[model samples]
Target: MRLRYLLLTLGIVVLGLLSRKTSICSIDFVRMYVGDVLWAMMVYFGCRLLFVSLKKSASFGVALSFSYLIEVSQLYHAPWIDSIRATTLGGLVLGFGFLWSDIACYTVGVTLGFWVDSLPGWGRK
Candidate 1:
């Protein structure tokens, strides 16, 4: 169970890195942040691996909410967090300070993730 989650997170993180390296920011990220898409996919995969009940799809919403939480947190950047954000990985996770527009982006990404999980091969037992 734990390993599955670890791999899910790793895959999402790798996707984030690839997105950055590829400069594929065409996805209206200003209105829907980047990580939420990958995060939603991770949530789907995590629930699948754990054999979670279908009702637990709420967890994907919760994961989507988390990105907003992180963005709001940027409004008050602690020194350590700022330093961590300076790191390439941290920068991707934390982003550049706070931007209210990202809330919408996250919502879109989360919804997209939900649809992805609903695809033919996904979220199956």
Candidate 2:
């Protein structure tokens, strides 16, 4: 189960990276929104991987809260944090700006994660 989540998180990361490429996802809307959606999904899977015993509801809540926190953190700008955001990883994890749409995307992603987790057989130990 942990391995499944690890692979799913890695796959989502790759897809999120690919979503940034114009050649792969030419639509500006998709390029912008899909990455955020995938980011949330990755967060959900990461929670599952780290906390295998967490209930689906708890996992969803934690993932959603963490995603929102990361998005909200973007509103703060300081040289120390900005320098961190300047790096490739920091840019990806912290993001550059806030968007209400990203919040909506996160809701969708976390909801989808919950739905996926609820599927039969997937929940069994």
Q: Give the per-residue lDDT digits (tens) of candidate 2, residues 50-114.
A: 98888889999999999999999999999999999999999999999999999999999988878
Per-prediction TM-score to the true structure, in the order listed: 0.63, 0.96
lDDT tens string, model 1, 1-125? 44744576678767755655435555555225465556545645555555455443675656666767877888876788889989977876677667655676666656666675666754432
| Candidate 1 residue spans exceeding 4 A from truth | 1-12, 22-56
Candidate 1, clashing residue pairs? 31-105, 32-105, 32-106, 33-105
* Candidate 2: segments with Cα more than 4 A from true spot: none
Worst 10 residues of 2 by lDDT: 116-125
